[model samples]
Target: MATRFLIEGRVQGVGYRNWLQEEARRRGLRGTVRNLSDGRVEAVIIGSYEETDAMLAACRKGPPLAKVSGIGLDPIDDPDVSGFIVLRDY
Candidate 1:
């Protein structure tokens, strides 16, 4: 399964993407995380239901520096991706 997360609030300059990458990798999830031009962080997580849910939970808290006011989740019908990656800013 694949889900896209748009994380907002103090996420842009707080190493949110890198931190999310580590979290995803630690959970054995495969996909990408990037910073959006609008100051939010975006992550595409592809994994089992449990893994995806776990990632979403972590995103709610985010890194220590991130305020994480809101997290927007969208179900995606995309092909599965391999490995977790830190993508260029979107």
Candidate 2:
């Protein structure tokens, strides 16, 4: 199963996506993370249940500059994603 997350708070301009990319890679996850115009960071990570859980845990703290306030999870029907990328700002 694929898991998508919408993280709201002080996420943009804080290297949150970049940090997430690194951490996701470290955990061998496949997905993308991007910034939303509504001042949120969104990510879709496809991996084992344990790895996805770890990714969510990391998202709670985020980078040193990020002040994460909330995280919303949604399970998607799509197949596992490919590589991880920092998508263009939305």
Candidate 3:
């Protein structure tokens, strides 16, 4: 399964992408994470339902520097990536 997460609040410039990369990879998920122009962080995660849900929970809290106010989630087609990565800003 695959999912997209739009993470809001103090996400940019706070190592959110890198943090997500670590979290996703650690959970054996494959996909990408990037910064959005509108001050949010976007992550595309591909994994089992359990892994994806775990990642979402982690994202809600985010890194210590991130003050995540919320996260918007949507189901998406899997990108078929091999490993988790952090993408450049959009």
Candidate 4:
């Protein structure tokens, strides 16, 4: 299973997606992170419960450049996602 996260606040242009991808990969998590049209960053991380929880915690603080205001999470149905990547903005 995957968890989709919508991160709000000062996300764009701050290397948020790149930071997220690096973190996910470092934790052996599989997923993709992208910038949303609404100026938020969105990520779908597929990994174990523990890894997922840790990723969410890091997202709250984001990169040193980001001022994360909020992060909303939703359980996803995808179970085949592989590798971490920084995707183009939506």
Candidate 5:
């Protein structure tokens, strides 16, 4: 199973995406992180349930510069990500 998340609040321009990419890679997760024009960071991480949960916990705190307000999580039917990458703004 894959886990997708939409992280809201003080996410963009704060290295949140970059940090998420690194963290996901470190956890050996296949996923992508991107910045939304609505000032949210969206990510899809695919890994074991435990690893995905850990990633979500980390997203809740984010990087030092990030002020994460909320994290919305959902199970994805198909998250066909190859590897962790930082995607262009959507």
Candidate 6:
């Protein structure tokens, strides 16, 4: 399964992208994460049901410096991603 996550609040410049890459890799998931121009963090994640669910849970807290205020989830059919990447800001 694949999904997109829009993480808001204190996410930018907080190591959230690196944290996401590490978390997804640790969970054996594939995806990409980037800092959005609107000061949010966007992540495209692909994995099994359990892993994706776990990933969402982890994203809620993010890295130590991140103060996640909210998260928006959007289910998608794109699964072309591989490994986990911390993409350049978008």
Q: Can you write out model 4's per-residue Cα lDDT over 1-90, one digit (the tens) per residue?
A: 699999999999998988998888989999888998999999999988988999999999989999999999999887566699878778
How many clashes does each candidate structure show, in the order listed? 0, 0, 0, 0, 0, 0
RMSD of each: 1.0, 1.1, 0.7, 1.0, 0.9, 0.9
Per-residue accuracy of model 2 over 1-90 as CA lDDT, tens digit each: 589999999999988999999999988889989999899999998988898998999999999999999999999875556788888989
Q: Of models 1 and 3, which has the larger lDDT?
A: 3
Output the TM-score of candidate 5.
0.94
TM-score of decoy 4: 0.95
Worst 10 residues of 1 by lDDT: 78-87
**Model 1: pairs clashing at backbone N, Cα or C within 3 Å:** none
Model 1 clash tally?
Answer: 0
Runs with alpha carbons beyond 4 Å of true place in candidate 5: none
Candidate 6 displacement at residue 86 in angstroms: 1.5
- Give the per-residue Cα lDDT of candidate 6 at 30: 90
Instruction: Please write out the lDDT profile of model 1 over residues 1-90, one tens digit for every residue.
Output: 899999889998888888999999988889998888999888999998999998889899988988999989999986567799988886
Clashes of 3: 0
**Clash pairs of candidate 2?**
none
Task: Output the better candidate (1/4) by TM-score.
Answer: 4
- The lDDT of model 6 is 0.90
Each candidate structure's TM-score, on Cα atoms with residue i matched to residue i, is 0.93, 0.94, 0.96, 0.95, 0.94, 0.95
